[model samples]
Target chain A: MDYTDYYKLTCSEIQKLYRENKASPEQVVDSYLKRIEAVDGKLNAFVKLNRESIDKQLKDLKEKKEKPLYGIPVVIKDNICVRDEETTCASAILKGFKPPYDAAVIERLREAGAILLGKANMDEFAFGSSCETSCYGPTKNPWDLDRIPGGSSGGSAAAVSADEACLGLGSDTGGSIRQPAALCGVVGLKPTYGRVSRYGLIAFASSLDQIGPITKDVRDAALLLNVIGGHDPRDSTSVNAPKPDYTKSLINDIKGLKVAVPKEYFVGGIDKEVSLYIGEAIKTLGSLGAKIGEVSLPHTDYAVSAYYIIAPAEASSNLARFDGVQYGLRSKAAKDSLLEMYNRTRAEGFGSEAKRRVILGTYVLSSGYYDAYYLKALKVRTKIKEDLEAVFKEYDCIVTPTSPTPAFKIGEKKEDPLSMYLSDIFTIPVNLAGIPAISVPCGFTKNGLPVGLQILGKPFDEETLFKAAYAYEQNTEWHKRRPSL
Target chain B: MVSKDNNNKKSEIDVGYVAKLARLALTADEIKRLGKQLNDILGYIGKLNNVDTAKVQPTSHVLPLKNVERTDKVVPSLRIEETLKNAPLKENSFFKVPKVIE
Candidate 1:
C-alpha cells in the first residue's frame, strides 16, 4: 500500500492505524510532510513549516504516548503564536517576528501531544475573506486551484481539505474559519465569543475573534475543541464556562431537535444552487428526526455594515502596536524624528488592506464621527445579536448556507471590495452575535464547488451544533468526497 | 475641510486626516485610491443610521464584561534578554528608538 494513501485517512482512522500498529508516528508524519511538499506549491497553504521541531516533538511524544493527540500533526493559522516560532499573520510588518511565548492553545495542544506543523497562510492580520490579502500569496482552493479557498483561514481549511494535515486551528473574527472550511470541503467550527482563549491569537477584532478547529470531519473538530476549549487564567476575556466533552455530542440522534432556517439568510443575491443545496441539507436534518422551519433575523442586512465599522474600529486600536517598535520589521529612515520613524516604518510594513482598515477605523473612531458611525454600529450590533437570540429562544440551532456562494474565481471579486464583503453576508452576523457556528460539507455545485451548511447554536452550546452537523454529515456522502488534487 | 457630522452623511470623511491619526504615511496615490474605497465602504456603513437604535444599549463585547481580578503578587516573567529578543532594536534591556527629544 502506498504511503500517499495515508494522507487520505481521517484523524480517527489514523489513530486506529496507530492502535493497530499498522503505522508509526514517524511514518505518518513523513507521509504528511511528503504530501505537503508535493501539493503545497499549488495551494500555498502553509507559511512556515516547523521541520526543525518535528523530530523533537515526535521524540517527546514517545515519553507520553497516552496524550489524546499524541503524534497528530495539526496546522495552525499564522496568527496563533507558537513559542520561538515566527508568527507573521502573513503580514510583512510582522515578518521575522518570533514570539517568546506560546499561545494558550499551543500550550494545550503540546500538552495533548499534538505535533504542530508550520503556520498556515492567512489574510494579512485576517483583514480579508479571500486570503488574497496575505503577503504570502493566496491559498488556492484544493477543489479548484484557479479559485480561492474562502478565507482568512483559507490556508488552514485548504490544508485539512487537501489532507496535508490531520487537523487545523483557525481564528474566526467573522467567517474566516467556517467560510474557508465550506469552500474547501471540510468542517470548520467557530466557537462562541470567549469560548476559546485568545491570548496568543493576533487580534483582528478583540470582541469578534475566536480560535476554533478546522478538520476533515465533525468528530475531529469536536476532538480538537475538547482539547483546546475552557478557561485560561492568562486571557482575561476567556469565559469561565465549563468545557463539556464535545465528543459526547457526536450522538447520531438529532431526533426531536428544533432547527430554524433564518429567512434573512435565504434572501436574494445568494446563489440559486447554493440555496438548493442548503434546502436539501435542512431536509436531511428533518429526515434525521429533527424539526426544521423558517425564522427571521430582521436586522440581518445591517450586520455587515455594523461589522465593517466595529471590526475596523477595534482593529485600528489593536493594530496601533505595529509601529515598528518592539518587534517585527523596522524600516531604515536616516532622519529620526521618532514620529517619522513610526510613519515610515508603518508605511513600509503594512499592506494596502491593513492600511485601509486602520485608516477606516481611525475615521470612525475619530471624535467627530465616533457617535455617528462607531457608536451607531455598536447599537446595530445589539440589534443583530438580539435578532439571533430571539430566534435561538425558539430554536435549538439555526441553519443556513455557510457562504452566499461557493468558492469563486481568484480575481472575481478583487475589483470590487464591497462585493467581496458581501460574500460574507450570511456568515458575518454569526460573529457579530457572538454565537457558535459550524460549517459542514453539504453538497457540491454543478461546477463541483462544495457547499457549506452553516449550523449556528446559542452561545456556548456547541454541543447542539455538533450533534446536528454530525447527524447530517453521517447521513450524507458529502464530507467523504475528496478534492482530486 | 472636514466637519463633525451629526448625521451619518458622507461629510467629507478625510482619509488623509484619518490616515495621520492612524500614524500611517500613505502615499498620495494610496491616499487617493484608499480615500475612494473608504468612502464607498462608509456609504454602505451608512445603513446603520437607518436602524432605530433609539433606546438600545450598544454591545461592545458580546459577552458581559467583568473585571478579572488577581492577587497583586508578582510572578516569574521572561528574562530581560528573552523579552528583548524580538525587539528590532535594543540597547541593554531597553528598546532603542530614534531620538525622541529634539
Candidate 2:
C-alpha cells in the first residue's frame, strides 16, 4: 500500500489491516515517522518524536493481536505523561522533566496496544488559546500556515488533521480539545468531567480538566474513548459510574433527538460566516429528523467570566508544585536564598500567559478579595450549571458554533489577552457545566478555514453526544475533507 | 443591578501585591504590561457582579463526591534514589535547600 494511504487510514481501519496481516505495526509506524519528518518542519505539531520507543513497542506488539487499539499510532498532548518520556507541558520550567509513571490514559492505551507516536506541542501549561505560547515556538495551522490551530491542544488537533497520527489524546481545561479540533477540521471530544481519570495528567484546573480524544472521525473518537474512559481508584475525582460501549452509540439515526440552539450563543460578536454555517448545520440536523429549536441559557454571558476566575484560581493552587526544587528547571541565580530561588525559578520558568494567570489567580484567591472575585465566580459558575441543567431537562442536546470565528492569524490575538480568552467563549460553558461535548467539522469559510458545530450533552451522557454528532457527521462531507499541507 | 462603584474598585487590582502573593518576581516592564492586561480581564469578568448571586452556593466541584478516602494502609512508595532523582540539589538522600538561618 502507498504510504499516503497508510497514513490516511483511521484507527479502526488500521486495526483491520493489522488483523488481516496485510500491514505490520512496524510499517505503520515507519510511515507515520516519515510523514512527521516531512510535514512537521512546516507544521511544528510534535515536540518530541518517539522513534526508538515506538520501534520497541512495535517489536513487542508483534507478539499480541487481541487488543482493540493494537498497532495504531497515537499522538498525545504534552501534558499527558508517557512514562520515562519527556512530558514537558510546553513550558520552560519542565523542559527536561520525564515523568517516572505513565498517565492512566497512557497506561490504558499501552495495554490496548496503541503505539505512542510522540508528544504534541501545546500552549505553555495549557494556559493560552493558541499554540503560539509554547516555549518551543508556535504550531502553525496545517490549513493555513500563517494561522493558528486553536489551542492549547493545537498540536494534537493539527496532527490528527494533517494525518500525522491516527488519533490524539488532549486535556481540555476550557475548550482546549474541542476548539482546536474545530480549527484543525477534525473531531475532538471533551468527555464529562471525571468520566476519564486524571491520574498523571499535569493539572491545569483540577475540576475542569478532562483528557479526551481528537480523532480523524467520530467513529475513531468513540473507539479511542472506549479504551481510555473508565473509573480509576487513583483519581479521586473519577466518577464510579458504569462505562458504556461508546461504539454502540455511533448509529447514524437522530430521528427523535432534541437539539437546542441557545439564543445567547448566536448573539452579537459572532462572525457572520460562522453563524451562517452553524445555522445551516442546524437546518441539516433538522432535515435529518432531529427536533431543533432555539432555547434560552440566561447566564450564558457569564460563563467566560466565571471560567476565568475558577480555572485560574485552581491553576494557581495546582501549579504551586513546580518550585524548581524537584522535577523541573531550577534557577542558578538564587543559590544563596530559598525565597529568591522560588521567586526566580517561577518567574523565569513560566511564560507570559502562565505568569498572567498565576498572578490573576493569586489575586482572586487572596485575602479580602476572595469573597468578591473567587467566591463570586463560583456562585456564578453554579448559576451557569443550573442554567444548563434546566435546559437539559427539556432538550437532549445543545448545538452551537464551536468558535465564534475560524482560525485567526498566528499573532493576531497573542498580544491581547482578553481577545485570546474570548476564543473559547462558545466551548467554555460546557466545561463549567461538567458535561460532555464534541466539536465536529461542519463547514468552511470563504477563506478556506473550517468551522465546527458543537454538540453538548448532559454529564456522563457522551452516548447521546456521539449519537447526535455521528448523525450530523454521516450526513455531511466536512469530516472527510483534509488540508493540503 | 450591582453598583458601578463596587465594580470599579474591584477592577483596580494591585499587580505588585498579587505578584508578591504568587511568589513571582517580575521586572518593572512586566508589572506594567501585566497590570494593564489584568485590569482588562478583570473588567470583562466584572460583568459577573451584575448577576444576583445572593442565594447561590459556590460550586467547587461539579460532581457531588466529597471526602474521597482510601483505607489507611501502608503502601510502597518511590525508592529514595528515585524520589531524589529529579531534585536540583540534594545531599545525603535529602533535597537540599539554601540555608534558612545563620
Candidate 3:
C-alpha cells in the first residue's frame, strides 16, 4: 500500500496491513509524520510533535507483547502528560513544563505498543468551548478551516477527523470531546465519569472530567476504549466495576431497545438543520426496531448555569498548583513578595478566559457568597443528576444533538463568553450527571458541516450506547464522510 | 457580595476584588471588561436560584464509593533531578521561590 493511503486506515485496518506484511510500524509512523508535515501547518491540530520519540517507541515495540492498539498512532490531548514531553494544556502559564511521568492512558498505550502521535491543542486550561483560547492558537476544523472544531477537545477531534491520527484521546469536562467530534464528523465518547482514570489528565472541573476516545467510527471508539477503560488504583475515583470488552458491545442490533428523546433538547436554540438530521436519525432508530419516545429532563435548562459555577470552582482549585514554585513560567517581575509573584505570574501567564473563570470561581467560593453560588450550584447538580437517573430508570438511553449548532465561524463566538458557554449546553448535562455519552455523525447540514447525534446511557453502561450507536451508524453513511482536505 | 443596580438587579460585582482573591492581577481595562462579562455571566448563573434543591443532597461525586484506599506501602518516587527538571528557578535540589518573609 502507498504511504499516502496509510493515513486513511483505522486502528484495526493498520493492524491488518501489518499481518499482511504490507506495512511495518516504522513505515506507518513515517506516513503519519509526512502527512502531518503536509497538512498540520494549515490545521494547527498539534501543539507539539514527538518526532524523536516515535523512533524510541518503535524500537520499544519490538520487545513488547502484541496488544490491541499495537502500531496504531493515537493523538493525545495536550493536557495528558507524556513523560519528558511538554504537557501544557495549551496554557502559557504551563509553557515548557514537561512531566516526569506518562499519563495513565499513555502508559496503557505504550503497554499496547501504540505510537505516541503528538499533543493536540486545546482551550487553555479547558476553559473555552471554541478552542480559540489556546495559547498555541486555535486548531482549524477539518470540515471548514474558517470554522471552529467544537472544543475544548477541538484539536483532538479535528486530528482524528482529518485522519491525522487513527484515534485521539480527549478529556470531556463539558462537551469538549463529543462536541468537537460532532462538528468535525468523527465519533467521540466520554465514558462514564469514573470508567477511565483521570490520574494524569490535567484537572479541569474534576467532578466532570473524564478522558475518552475520539475516532473515525464507533468500532474504533470501542477498540480504543477497550485499551484505556479500567479501574486504576492511582485514580481513587475510577470505578472498580468489571471492565467489559467494549468491542463485544458493537453489535448491529438495538432491536427492542428503549430510547428517549429529551424534549427540552429540541425545544429552543437548536439549529433547524441539526434537528432535522437528528429527527431523521430517530426515525432510523425506530425503523431499526428500537422503541422511541419523548422524555423531559426539566433540569436541562439550568445545566449551563450550574456547570459555569461548579466547573470553575473546581478549576480554580485545580489550577492553583500552577504557581511558579514547582514548574512552568515564573513571572520576571516576581521579585519582592510571594503574593506579588503569584499575582503577577498568573496575571501574565493566564489568558483572558482563564482569568475570567478563575475570578468567577473565586467569587462563587468566596465567603458570604458560597451558599448563594457554590453550594447552590452543587445542589442544582444533584437535581440534574436526578433528572438523568429518573430517565434511565425507565429508558435504556437518551438521544439528543451533541451541540446546538454546527461549526460556527472561528471568531464568531470568541468575544461573547455567554454565547461560547451555550455551545456546550447539550453536552454539559451529561458531565453534571456523570453518565456516559457518545457523539456520532448523524448527518451534515445543507452547508456541508456535520451535525452529531449524542447517545447518553446509564452510569457504567457505555456498552448499551455502543450497541445503539453502532446500530444507527451501520445504517448511515455520515461517519464515512471525510473532509476534502 | 452582589449590589443592586439602578434596575434593582444584582449587577455590580467587584471584579478587581475577585481577581485579587483568585491571585490574578489585572489591569484597569481588564477589570472593567471582565467585570461586565462576569456580571452578565453571573446573571445567567442566577437561573440556578429557581431550582428547589433545599431538600436535595448535593452530589459532589457521581460514584457511590468512598475512601478509595490503596495499600499504604512506600514505592519509588521521582529522583531529585527529575522532580526539579521543570523548576523555572532552582537551587541545588530545591525549587527557588520569592522570599515570603518581609
Candidate 4:
C-alpha cells in the first residue's frame, strides 16, 4: 500500500501489519510524524507535537507488545490534559499551561500503548462551534483550503483527514466532535455522557461534555472507544457500567434493523444538499434490508435553545477557576482592586467567543432571571430527554444529517454566533438526551464537501450503532475517498 | 380570576447590577453594549413562552438516573506538591486567591 494509504488504514489493519512484521510500531509513528511535518503547516491542526513522547512509546511497543492499543498513535483536542504536554484548549489564557497529570481517558490510552501525538487546536476553551476562535490559527479543512473543518474538534478531525494521525480523541459538548467529523469526512463517536471519563478535560459544559473518538473508520472509532470508555473514580460522573466489545459486533448486518428518521430533523431549515444526501442514505439502508420509519422527537426544535442556556450556565460556573491567581493567564499590570485584577486577567486571557459566552451565561444565571432562563431551560432539557426515550422505544436507532450544511468558507459564521450554533442543531439533541451518537461520512455535497449521517442509539447500545454504521460504510464508497491535501 | 404573571421581569435590574452578576466591571461602552445584547438574547428566549406548556411537566435532566453514590473511601493520589506545582499562584499547598475583602 502507498504510504499515504497507511494513514487511512484502520487500527485493525495496522495491528495486523505489526503482528505480521510487515510494519513496526516505530515505522507507524515515524510515518505519521513525517506526514504532519509535510502538511501541518498548511492545516495548523496541531498546536503541540510531542515527538519525544511518541518516540518513547514506539520504542516501548517494540520491546513488548503487551497493551491492547500498543503503538497506535492518537491526536487529542487541546482541552484534554496530557501530563507535561501543553493543554491550552487553543486559548491564550492557557498559553503555556501544562497539566500535572493525565486525563482519565489519556491514562487509559497510555495503558493500552497508544502513542500520544500532541494537542490539536480547538475553539478557545471549546466554547465555539467553529475553530476560528482558536488562539492558534483556525484549522482549515484539508479537503478544501478555503472552507472550514467544522469544530471545536476541527483540528482533531483535520489532522485525521490530512493523514497526520490515524485516530484522535475529542471532547464533544454540543456538536464539537460530530460536526467536525462530518465536515472533514471522518468518523467521530460521542458516547453517552458518562460512558467515558471526563476527569481532566478543561471544562466547556460539564453536563454536556463527553470525551469521544475521531477516527478514519467505524471500527477504529470502536477500538478507541474500548480503550477510553469506562468508569474512573477520578471522574464522579463516569458511568459504572461494564465495558462491551464494540469491535466484536461491527460486522453484524444491520438487516431488519429499525431506524427512525425524525420529522423535525428533515424540516425545511436543513440544507437542501445535506437533506438530499441523508434522504438517499435512508433509501440506501432500505435497499440493504433495513426498516426505516418516521419517528417524532417533538421537542427536538428546542434542542439548540435549551443547549445554549444549560451549556453556558454550566460553563460560567466551570470557568470561574481560571481567575488570575489559580491557573493560566494573569494580568501583570492591573493595579486596581482585586476584582479588577480578575476581570482584567480574564479579559486579556480569553478570546472573544469565550468572553461572549461567559457574559451570556452569567446573565442567564443571575438571581432574578435564574428561574425564567436557567431553570426553565433545564426543565425543557428534561422534556427533550423524555422525547428521545419515547422515540427510542419504537426504533433500534435514530438517523439524521450530522450537520445542516457541508463545509463553508472559514469565516462564514465567525461573527454570527447564532448561525454558528445552528450548525449543530441536529447533533445537540443526542448530547442533551445522553445517548450514544456517531457521525459517518455518508456522502458529499455538490461542492465536493463531505456530509455525515448521524446514527444514534440508546445509552450503552454503541454495538447496534456500530453495526448499522459499519453496514452502511461497507456499502458506500464515501469513507474510501481521501481529501486531496 | 386569580393568576400570577410568569413573564414579569424583575423591575430593579440596572446596568451595574447586571454587570456585577456577570462578573464584569463595565465601562460606559460595555454597559451599553451588554444592555443591548442581553435585551436581544432575552427577547429571543422569550419566544419559548409561546409553547402551551401548562400541563407539560418541566424536564430538567435527560436520563431518569438518580445520583449513584459510591463508598466514601479515599484513594491515594499524586503528591500535593506535584498537583499544586502548576497552579499560577500557590501558598502552603493551597491555590492562592486574590483577597476580595479586607
Supply DockQ values for each candidate. 0.71, 0.71, 0.68, 0.38
Pairwise DockQ winner, candidates 2 and 3: 2
Q: What's model 2's lDDT at B68?
A: 91
lDDT by residue for model 3 over B1-102, one digit each (tens)? Answer: 233322336856898888888888899999999988898998888877678877988878888887777888999989999999999899999999888887
- Summing lDDT over every window of 10 consecutive residues in candidate 4 chain A, give the lowest-scoring window: A1-10
At residue A282, what lDDT does model 1 achieve?
85
My TM-score estimates for the predictions, one after another, are: 0.98, 0.98, 0.98, 0.94
TM-score of chain A as modeled in candidate 1 = 0.99
Top candidate when judged by lDDT against the true structure: 2
| Tens-digit lDDT track of model 1 for A235-297 | 888989889999999989988999998888887899999999998998889999998888988
lDDT of 2 by residue, A1-485 (tens): 77546998888889888778898887888888888988999999999998668778988886558988988999999999888899999999998887878999999999999999999999999998889999999999999999999899999999999999999999899999999999999999999999999999999999999999999999999999999999998999999999999999999899989999899999898999999999999999999999987899999999999999999999999889999887798999998988888999999999999999999899888887788888898999899999999989999999999999999999999999999999899999999989999999999999999999999999999999999999899999999999997
lDDT of 4: 0.83
Off by over 4 Å in 3: B1-8
Which sections of candidate 4 miss by over 4 Å? A2-5, A62-64, B1-16, B25-38, B55-60, B63-67, B72-74, B90-101
lDDT (C-alpha) at residue A408 in model 3: 98
Off by over 4 Å in 1: B1-9
Write out the backbone clash pairs for model 4.
A379-B59, A382-B59
In candidate 2, stretches whose alpha carbon ends up further than 4 angstroms from where it belongs are B1-10
